[model samples]
Target: MNNTDHTTATVEPAIRLESVTKQYVGAETVTALADVDLPVYGGEFLAIVGPSGSGKSTMLNLLGLLDGPTEGVVRLGGRDVTDLSETELTDARREYIGFVFQDFHLLPTLTAVENVTLPTAFTDGQYADRAVDLLGRVGLGDRLDHTPDELSGGQKQRVAIARALINRPEILLADEPTGNLDRETGVTILEEVRRICERGVAVVAVTHDELVTEYADRTVRLVDGRLGEGDDGFAT
Candidate 1:
C-alpha cells in the first residue's frame, strides 16, 4: 500500500452511535435523542454538555449499554450490539464498561476498600489486590477504613472512581460525576478521571458544567435531543 493509504487506515472506535434515536412511549411520546452520531476513541476523553432534559442522560445510557436505541445502532469495538440478548448485553457491559455516577453511590456502611472491591463479588475474589492499588492511585490509601459518611465529598468521589476501575473496563461512562461537589473538589475529581483516560480507557462524561470542557479532548453540545458541533484539540 502507498504511504498515504497506510497512514489513513481507520482504527475502530471503542464505542460508536450511528444515527441513533431514543424515545419514550408513555402517555405521550417523548424523544430523548435524535439521529445522534458519535465516536469515542480509546485513551481520549469526550464530554457531552447540554441543558436540563437535553438528552445527556439518554446518551450516557446508550453509550454504557444500559439501554438500547429506539432506532439505529450502537456499536462496541465496531460490532453492532443493538440487537443483543439481555444476557449477552449484561456480559458485554460487565466486560467492557464501567460507570461513575454523580452521587458517590458508595455504601454508607461499607469501608472504602470494601466498596472498591464490590465488583469482584461477581467473579473470583482475585481482584482484591488490584482494588487496594486502585484506591491508592485515587489518593484514598490512608482512608481505606473509612465509610462514605466518614469521608469528605472529594474523598468519597475518589472512592467511587476507584470502584469503577475494579473491573478494568475499556470504557468509563460518568454521569454528572462532579455535580455534587464544590468547584475545588470537582476539579480534583476531574483530575483523577483525566488520569484514568491517560491509562487508555475511553472516557465519556455527561455534564452541565462548562469547566469539564477544559479537561476533555473533545466536547459535543446537545440541544433539544440533537447533537451540535464538537470542539476538539484539548488533549494533553
Candidate 2:
C-alpha cells in the first residue's frame, strides 16, 4: 500500500478490536473469538454475518460494552477502555454507545416518545425535546403517542431506531435488527439504518440475513470464532 494511503487509514475509528478473543469456561472451555482485528469508522455501516454458535453475539457484546474480551483491546473513540471500572464503563456505555434489538425491546406501557426518552434516566441531561426530534427523524412524528402494541413491526423498529438515537450516541450496535420483520419491512428498516449511518454514526449490525448486507458499506463473516473478509453481496 502507498504510505499516504496507509497514513490516512490510521485515522481513529469509532470502535476497534485488536486481537480480541473471548472464552467461556464451563465443564469444558469454549473459545468464541480469536485474534480478531476490526476497525469500524464513523459514517460507515458494517454487517457481521455468521451462523448459530459462531460468536457473532459475543463480538456485539464486546462492542456494546456489555461484556469484555477475555483477551485483547477494545477501543472506543481511539481509547483503550478494557480496564475501566464498572461505573466508568456504565458511563461510557451511556454516553457513547446505543443499541437496537430484534424484538424492538420497547417497554409495553410507554408511548413512542416516552420509549425514546428512556435512556435519559441514566444521565444528567434532559432529552425530551431531543427524543421528539429523533422520532420525527425516523418518520414517527405522527405516531409519538402510540404504544408498541399499537404500532406495526416496521413502525416499532422505527421507534427503536429513534430510541437508539435519543442519547446522540457515536456508535449504534444492532443485533438482528430486522430479524422479526417480513422481507419488505426488513428492507425498509435497513434503509432507515443506512440513512442514519450516512449522517455519521458508526453502525455495526450482526445479522443472519444476507439481504441485510446489501445496505452495508462492508461486510465480514465469522465462522468458528474467526474473522475474515465477507461478501460484497454476502453468502451463508
Best by lDDT: 2
- State the C-alpha lDDT per candidate: 0.88, 0.89
Q: Which stretches of candidate 1 lie over 4 Å from their true place?
A: 1-8, 231-236
Question: Where in model 2 is the C-alpha error above 4 Å?
Answer: 1-9, 122-126, 230-236
By summed lDDT, the worst window of 10 consecutive residues in model 1 runs over 1-10
TM-score of each: 0.93, 0.93
- Cα lDDT tens digits, model 2, 98-130, are 999999999999999889999887654468788
Show the colliding residue pairs in model 2: none
User: On residues 1-236, what C-alpha lDDT tens digit does candidate 1 reach at each position?
Assistant: 01123566877789999999999999999999999999998889999987889899999999999999999999998889999999999889988898999987889899998999887776777777788899999988888899899999899989989988888898999998888899999999989889999988999999877778889889988888999865531212
Checking candidate 1 for backbone clashes, the offending pairs are none
